[model samples]
Target: MNYGPLLFLGVFLTLASSWCGLVLIPQLQLWKSGGLEAVKLEKTGEFYPPMRSGLAEHGREVYRANGCIYCHSQQVRPKGFGGDFLRNWGQRRSVGRDYLRDKPVMLGTMRTGPDLTNISLRQPSASWHMLHLYNPQITSPGSIMPPFRFLFETRKIRRMRSPDALDLKPPFAPPPGYEVVPKPEAQLLVDYLLSLRAVTPLPETE
Candidate 1:
């Protein structure tokens, strides 16, 4: 009674079903439980609008296409030895509700680049982000971040366009010879990044 093939098929199917039932199914259920909707901040002191910009959506696509998740993460682990807990990065631990609006959570697995959960607070300057995106090596000489020059353009400073003048359509194209900037996408991404602040208040005990 050689049951080698049958046993292998049975084991594979069991593991596959178990993995999907336990992990994938639950995740899908969680996703379906709530769609993107704003929640009031507990602190309210530092409240800003949840990312509702068209650029944020475009930036999300850019984030996915670039595989930024492969290097950086969006989640801040529970406070501990992880770099995120360090004073230099942020002052609070992240919570599940903080990411309630995220459709596909970007809690990446790797840590090639520092966690970007608090980048907006850490380096709020738009110029800094632009320079970094244009040429990572220029800002941090040792940075492993690949340059995204293709996403931007360069030219001398000139007349500024009114905020109301921006087109909110997809495939956001900047005006000619105006140094089509990455910060347009970076700004929205930064906005979303900034929005990653944990709604949970910090514990009093050290």
Candidate 2:
């Protein structure tokens, strides 16, 4: 006759336990030791530094706004997990520490495009990134990424082209009388992409 009160108590206990296990436990673990464990350096004593440049951070926002995550995954799964290792997306599997400071990690869900975790190392030239962004086909002959031309401008060629103007060749050229110069946003985005690299050798991830 009084089973309703007992049932309510049991439900409350179950919910409390679930919340403690799911939320509290993870928070405690991640924040324990002042979170120093999450940011410890690798065996080589090298640590991946945070984004120091404002342009790079702004570029990250631009990347998110552009929905680059929909087509790309920054993660590199270990050998048994997927082809990420085989494809050389990264030198080693990504670790939690690699993204500890990411705030909102960019480890996307799909691999429509290659992982950009180490793109700065993969192609170190800013010009290449600019060309690719202006029109993917310019750098990658068959890349399906659409050109972000609005991020650039075509202005009449003055006596001297803007120092930041792209060095376009034949087919990728804008026009004889005009030159392609990346606007500030494009420059920042390129800088950000160029800054993405994993230098440390984290064996635990492998």
Candidate 3:
């Protein structure tokens, strides 16, 4: 009996099965279904209140320009997959609907820093984020993340320090007569970061 045909058929079938199971199936389920829901959300309105706003939209551009995706990721792995659960990044596995509105999905590869999928919920204060962006060390002492001091402006005080001025201490603080305020780009970027949170729960959890 000739085994050449049998061997070739077996290899082809195995490849076909793998492609269907791994690629085609997930594409149909995740992409097709999600694409539909995204359109429906636009037509019928969002299930949850709109979170991402104009400020966040502009801030996202600023975030991209700064290459934040290089160091920080915006995803959370499932409980069994990794330490994401232990790190308390999110209560549930991040789903497609969570980012349906995002035009340029930023599901970053590396986790050089903590996940930002739910950072807004964890740290809701705008002031805190401003301070952190100005100098990561102020919030996370000895942090490897470099300070974005260029995002801040040191201006001579005219009256009292602006309410938005950073309360940097000691070595990080501005000169005696100067105060540091986040630039417009920095403000927008922080707004975008503050908008990141898993507000819409999945049906499985509901």
Clashing pairs in 2: none
lDDT for each residue of candidate 3 in 1-206, tens digit (9 for 90 to 100): 47999989999999999999998997798875654253324445666425578999999999999999998899888878998888889888877667767778899988888899999989999988988888888888888888898999999999788988988889988889999998999999998998898745556334
lDDT (C-alpha) at residue 138 in model 1: 61
lDDT of 2: 0.81
Q: In candidate 2, what are the lDDT values of residues 12-56, reduced to their tens digit?
A: 999999899998987787677344344446554544545448888
Best by lDDT: 3
Per-model lDDT: 0.62, 0.81, 0.83
Ranking by lDDT: 3, 2, 1
Model 3 spans with C-alpha error above 4 angstroms: 1-28, 31-51, 204-206
Q: Tell me the number of clashing residue pairs for each predicted model.
A: 0, 0, 0
Model 1: per-residue Cα lDDT over 1-206, one tens digit each: 47999999988999999899999987787567532234455676533235546666666777887788999887776667666676455566655555655667788998899888778777776566656776676668888898787666454446774432323122333445344445466656544544444434533212
TM-score to native of every candidate shown:
0.65, 0.82, 0.80
Show where candidate 2 strays beyond 4 Å.
1-20, 33-47
